[model samples]
Target: MFDEKNIWDTFRYGDESSFKLIFEQFYTPLFNYGHKFTVDDHIIEDALQDLFVKLWKNKDSIRETSSVKNYLYKAFRRVLLRKLSYAPQVVGFSSPEDKLDFNFQLGHDHTLISQERLQQIRQSLSDALKKMTPRQREIIHLRYYEEMEYEEIADIMQLSVSSTYKLLYRAIETLRNNLSNTDFLLLLSLLSLKKV
Candidate 1:
């Protein structure tokens, strides 16, 4: 029932209600998308808040978006990249086990899965993601988790559209190979059944 165009128009016309609506709709998804990049919750929170504040301040200059979701995601990705550039070196992976541990802790879902299964699935995905280069993981996160267009991702990562596609293709192949070695079929079955 939420009309994105109407909401944008209202926001452009200085309507607080429309801006509030947009924030409410996108807050969680954007947070989750940001989490896929960094383990720091405070950093993610600050980034999202700053991104929305900027959106409101620059409302008049905002272009017509084919998808509001994509617009928000692109903005979030840019903010995250800027934040990462300045963050401490400790933010980078220190070890494979450390990365896996952090990722498992970050993506663990208590409501969606039993603690044991959550740990197992989280470890599996974490290990797979850790095997990927930082750039590849960033691209995959932007494309799949954030749902940005390839062109937008290319602009964000400073790569050509074809290069972005190739990066994603290779990342997917790597993920498939890594995940395939685990109890991936069982995990998928559990995920599909909502019993994970």
Candidate 2:
């Protein structure tokens, strides 16, 4: 298995190869995480670029983190939020639903099942997710999709640890209530597809 601590230590030692590995491991996830907050590709790309650039520049001074993923996530969230604060109108959509941009894609074709059935499941999961409030959706994404710890999520979302757990629990409970057991299973599998 790949060890993040070892990779992080290597990068902190000013090894360019380790830095490249870290970037390759996290770029897509950071992009996806940022995309959940806003739809603007340019802003997300810029934030990611700034994040990596700063990481490389300050590698020697950066503290060793128990969870590098969590640290990066918190840093990325701060970068995006700070950028958005300067241009609040960028996310000035009237409703949380309007700001949502969740989409599900099937990884492969299923010969045993009709395409229509697959579509139905996909649609059902999407609908179920859409029904959630923006905060709820975010909590689910961080907690489930990102596999982040409650403390890490709390720090990123600016919530208390207890609040983070309650929020995630409520989001899962709401999703469970809205979806049938089979549909819930499909949603879980779909969300886990990319491991973030």
- Highest TM-score model number: 2
What's the lDDT for residue 123 in model 1?
A: 66
Q: Kindly list the per-residue Cα lDDT of model 1 for residues 161-181, writing each as its tens digit.
A: 999989998888888888787
lDDT of 2 by residue, 87-180 (tens): 7777612235655656777758688877877887676667667777667878889987888778888998889999998998888877777678
Runs in model 1 deviating more than 4 A are: 89-126, 142-158, 179-196
TM-score of each: 0.70, 0.74
Q: Which candidate is the best by lDDT?
A: 2
For each candidate, the alpha-carbon lDDT, in order, equals 0.77, 0.80
Residue 132, model 2: lDDT of: 73
Model 1 whole-model lDDT (C-alpha atoms): 0.77
Model 2, stretches more than 4 Å misplaced? 92-101, 105-121, 173-196
